[model samples]
Target: MVVLFLATSFFCVGQAAKDRFKDWAQTPPMGWNSWDCYGPTVQEHEVKANADYMASHLKDYGWDYVVVDIRWFVENTKRHGYNQIDPRYVLDAYGRYMPATNRFPSASDGSGFKALADYVHQKGLKFGIHIMRGIPTEAVKRKLPIKGTDGITADQVYTTENQCKWLKDNYTIVADKPGAQEYYDSIFELYAEWGVDFVKIDDLSAPIYHEDEINLIRKAIDKCGRPIVLSTSPGATPVTAGPHVSEHANMWRMVNDVWDHWRHLDHLIGVSQDWFSYIKPGTWPDCDMIPLGRLSIRGERGDDRMTSLTKDEQYTLMTFFTIFRSPLMFGGDLPSNDDFTLSLLTNKEVLKMHAESSQVRSLYYDEDKTAITSKNENEDWTYLALFNLSDSAPSDVWVNLSDMGMEGPVKISNMWTNEVLGTVKGKFTQNLAPHASGLYKIEKD
Candidate 1:
């Protein structure tokens, strides 16, 4: 009888957690983030411009979610720069950071992000924001009151020892402290009231593995009475923590920031292999954002320019992310995207692989090449990607049909080119360019 009660209690807890976030992110999210292009200084007009572009051009292709990434509350952020010390961040009486009215004009008059969120919603897209994972250092120093609590203040729950190594703007919350959970709850409650659809919490995921804080945030999200997709960032997330993270977040980064560099792209192949088994319906092991087209305009990185990735490498990057079923967050400036980048972003067949494919696995990998395969849920279509990791001349990249559990005479269509390359048996091969890829859909002939 004791064992039976334990089993029932465990099942009830699991079901409740699952049910709470079930309606959020039914599949991997496809969206654009402001980080790579505008960095911490993205303004209201810039955000709306991107949303307008997505709604008018890319929404039909399943691209949505315009996320304002990082430090939207720091006043005079453009002049101070992102990582520099600034004493003028906008914060409320409860010590929670609020949008800087000068930057996000719509947030003036206590409106917060509601007006901007409504604008995004009207554009037929979802809105998201990036946040550091703890109480602002300024708040703790000022001993600001914790909302929804009688006597608790920010200092009571914050710990300097647990702060983010790279960013010192915030102090990590001590999960065991008296007002810790209340602080998280109050912030998420405000976010819910602001109609936030997604929140990407940074500095709390991966290497830190702040399980207690994560759970508190999860509880806060659940009690907020809204469906907000949670994404954790700056990964190299420990594979062993997959179960815990999957239970708490809709998406979690699998690598550190991914840029257009070939080395970064190559690194993702291995990261994807390690985390492939962790992916399920609602939770995704993110490969970070696709940094293509015009990037780093006003960002922390280098000067504004088109992506340094060659055209072939660009195709390979998209194919890799799509077949792996990673959440696609384009990091380029949308308005400045050229024809080639636009074509890549708007490909229906490639997006299909991201949305519908499952059971993705790396069939093989080496210094020169990598092969991955997946199948649609119905099992009617099979997707395969062969990447040339080498910088040597283009050569035959082949995958044996038997490895894919398929036998001969199959019709193959190149997803990128949308060209039907007649029936083949035993093995399929393509003469891919150096650092290029061939993505194909295979079917029994």
Candidate 2:
């Protein structure tokens, strides 16, 4: 895969749908997704409970979208397939997926999700669903009747090569095909009528092919006459396609399923440094989610143990994620949360840096093992985030104001605690808490 970092100035053609993305995901969406936390086993009741919790607690901080992840089909719901039950329950004869009857009995009239979404909306929240990026395998095998705008079939709109790996079935939509737009338009139309505000299309980057189908999906959302925020998943959304995808997608994942582990965070941090340039307002580079607190489900294959990170390490991770402007999606179950976790998620000061700052860059670092310093652009005071990822070292990192295109003594204030520390010379240094961070505001004094 060729990864290219285009300068932010390069203009990509095609306007985003209905200007829906105008402010759709300006500060990176913060919400709950079922896949990472609950896997394919999430029932409608469990989802409603989670949504209820999010509405009551996390809404004040802007965590609104409640997404129902994969395996919602009826054919995939059968007990024999392990994870692949009846795909029919997830999707239906009309090519529309609804909540399973066993899980959501009200869905027999194609109104299960309709009721759920209504409830979510009544609570001042949004509803979303996930879908693999291809025609159903069963649909293709049975040559199911298609619902094309021009009376064409879905089979005519897609090809077999776009199938997802690790899954037994699904054909990728041929975005360039004659009826592709009409086919995509059909799905979004169903969703729009059902009141969906977000849709995550998966298997999108398998072998990372097809910019045409991507464009078609974007177009479908627009024609639906609804503002559906589109998110592409399991991104290794190649950097070569970054510029184009940034414009079309409100937010996209930057890695495979992120679990609650140290190595995952370590790897994600390194990969994101190269993505800083793509951190514009509407488009965000997602680092999966905060897998801390209480996550007890599949894909979260850890000791249902409490987060192993020390306070310092947790702060360091949160600081890096917030300053880098990654979407602050929490993966832990919201209904049962500790005060410590809530405090971290609801910190207004930390979130302010993520929402407001436009420019972020690495300012200084000694040997890679010792320390690293990052800078954020704040109109009033320049913000600095210093972290030490090393296991055994107390990182001593410094920043020189003059070198950063600034002058004079720098007055510093802690961004987290809001304590104004005294002034420093052109060069100022801080001893980092091991596996921790020091987020500071520097002003010209």
Candidate 3:
């Protein structure tokens, strides 16, 4: 059966043109992100501590990307109707964003980020940063100035119409313009100099729809002569622009900010049902981060916590995402993780399925339930995942391999517990806990 599945997947993609990004995401990309757990309030000290933990402990598992998320470069607050920049989100006089000098005393002037990025690389990991899609309006108004271009107003590069609605204003650039390319090129050159590896540009989804900007950013990265991966945020990218975005970006969000609530997952399963078929290499439909760990909510210390979810449900979410080979970005804090949460994150077998699964696709899903499978390129092994998404305790699930066109006994292993279920006939059966999922490996005899 594994061999058969391999043959089919190969046949489907063999004639297809090579996709640079798809090839990069065969097993999902694993990394740490600040948004889900930190929101817009992440500080340099917090980021440094997490980076240190990841380097010392999680680096061996391929958790390489250390991404510092939003509100990183706000210089002025007057334009946003505030007398000054939020004390929590202030950048220095230099246009670049760095850790607050007092909070992150190690990062003096532009020195901190370079040191952190260097530390991450020295520990055998990659460093990344996140930014909104448009030119920082504050940067524009204050004329803090761009790197290469001189005296160029932010309006000279972007249009007021392209501003993102939810966040403060960001003038969208017209990538097709010659000067526009220079503007982006300069920004990327600075990031390259800083040793940045991945960029997640947000707010490109709604108000200022800059489709060409995607191409421009790719061009800029290429011109910088670095292999930085570009990821877009905040929406299900339009199906019509699929091929275009796929050609440029390594990953794009398939849903808005996903939280630790079941309803968030509930809405995700509904909206992204059709998106599974589109989940191939390079252009991943990110489901956002896993928010199961410690979170700082509403100005309280680990207060504004996540919604109440059973351990089974949380694991079910993780299992489904793993089988999908989706990019796994943990949104929780490392130092504050509990035993159960740590167990989920450190499950080598489960993590391997996500990071090393060869083929990722939904075999079948219906009526608030799903059965997804992932196989390696050679078809020597396969992961068959069964999910029960209700609030009930447990449910029965029968899997049919007839469609795989196999007619022989096969060995199956329970991925989570590492317990082998022995050889079985072509048809398989199992019982799953409610809001739970099972990952099984099937092999032909």
Which candidate leads in lDDT?
1
Model 3, global lDDT:
0.69
Off by over 4 Å in 1: 1-16, 79-83
Candidate 3, residues 15-124: lDDT per residue as tens digits?
Answer: 35334445544545678887655665666677777788787777777677889776555432222122233433443343445555554455676664677688778878
lDDT of 1 at 49: 90
Clashes of each: 0, 20, 4
The C-alpha lDDT values of all candidates are 0.89, 0.71, 0.69
RMSD of each: 2.0, 5.8, 6.6
Best by TM-score: 1
Candidate order by decreasing TM-score: 1, 2, 3
lDDT for each residue of candidate 2 in 44-157, tens digit (9 for 90 to 100): 777788899988888887789888877766534422123544344355664555567776655677665788788889989899888877677666665555666555665676
Measured against the true structure, the TM-scores of the candidates, in listed sequence, are 0.96, 0.87, 0.85
Candidate 2 C-alpha error for residue 368, in Å: 3.1
